[model samples]
Target: DMNDIPPVFTTVPRPITLDDDVPIGTTVINLVAQDSDGTSPNNQ
Candidate 1:
């Protein structure tokens, strides 16, 4: 059966604190999302 399952956030970023002199372009955290459908386009 083909079912459309919505993507879920497998990894969620936690609250972060930045200093006043933080860089303009800085990566705070990384997030991960997964789809249960396990198919192209939808999975991605």
Candidate 2:
């Protein structure tokens, strides 16, 4: 939910999936990320 820092981390497919046994079409996941620099990597 942020665009102010370097993308040091990433998530595959933009979205992931749960319900390993049965995917009933109502599955969900969390696309997460974190920056090496919390405030600003560019020192802005």
- Choose the strongest candidate by lDDT: 1
lDDT tens digits, residue span 1-44, model 1: 24588878988768988899989888878899777886676666
Give Cα-based local distance difference scores for all models.
0.78, 0.54
Once superposed on the true structure, which residue ranges of model 2 sit more than 4 Å away at CA? Answer: 1-5, 15-28, 38-44
Query: Model 1, residue 27: displacement in angstroms?
Result: 0.6
**Model 1 TM-score relative to the real fold:** 0.55
Error of 1 at 3 (Å): 11
For candidate 1, list the clashing residue pairs, or say none.
none
The local lDDT score (0 to 100) that residue 31 gets in candidate 2 is: 61
Per-candidate TM vs. native?
0.55, 0.27
In the range 1-44, model 2's lDDT, one tens digit per residue, is 34466655467646555556775765476565656544543432
